[model samples]
Target: MLTTNDLMTIDPETVTADVPLREVVAVMNRANIRQVLVVDGKKLVGIVTDRDVRLAVNSPLTTEEPLQRLELLNGFKAKDCMTSNPRCVTPETPIHKVAELLSMYKFGALPVVKDDALVGIITVTDLLNQMALIPEPKS
Candidate 1:
């Protein structure tokens, strides 16, 4: 069984909750990644996904109508809208199990943690790429 550590993207992108939405969006776009871990001193605190940013931009957090993209982006921070306490897996978690969790939850990615410290991340794309690399058994 392949462990998460074997397949997870190590040193995955992360951000502090206090970071502005603009910066977070910039990082996500630059990395071409959908998820970013929110950490405080190496401890996992929350997570922000590309979906979250999209939804944030669209959500009317206040009574203000027709909020412009610039207004929304400048008005919020990661902690104000990030998904708190997202489900995570460990380094020892199996690849199959990770796939199952993603399928079951429709999660874009799962943070990898060990001893409560954020370590890596595994995504559906990662799983697919890993599976594609497997060699077929011969008769």
Candidate 2:
């Protein structure tokens, strides 16, 4: 059975929980990724998605001034907007199970962990890439 280890992105982009949201946006832009794993050392702690950053910076009730928006972004840290203790899968977890969890939870990715330490991350794009490599069976 294909597992996360077979298709996961090793050393995926990560950020410390104390990282400022502005920096998170920069990382995402530089990496061209939709989400980033929040970690403390090697341990998985949370996740912050692009949507989270967008919402944080573009709240309708908040001021429209760019200066205020900048302040808001700088004031918020990853921990403030991140989903704490996000569900995770081990590297040995089957890809189908990961797919199921992603579908059920509507998650873009799931952190891959081993021995309580972050190892990698498996995203919807990862599964799709693997699927593309599979050969078609006889009709």
Best by lDDT: 2
Q: How would you encode candidate 2's per-residue C-alpha lDDT over 4-106 as one tens digit per residue?
A: 9999999999999999999998999999999999999999999999988888889997888999999998999999999999999999999899999999999
lDDT of 1 by residue, 8-83 (tens): 8989888899999988998999999998889998999999998888888877654445457777888899998899
Q: For model 1, how many clashes? A: 0
TM-score of each: 0.90, 0.93
For model 1, where is the 10-residue window of minimal lDDT? Answer: 59-68
Error of 1 at 132 (Å): 1.5
How does residue 30 of candidate 1 score in lDDT? 94
Measured by TM-score, how close is model 2 to the native structure? 0.93
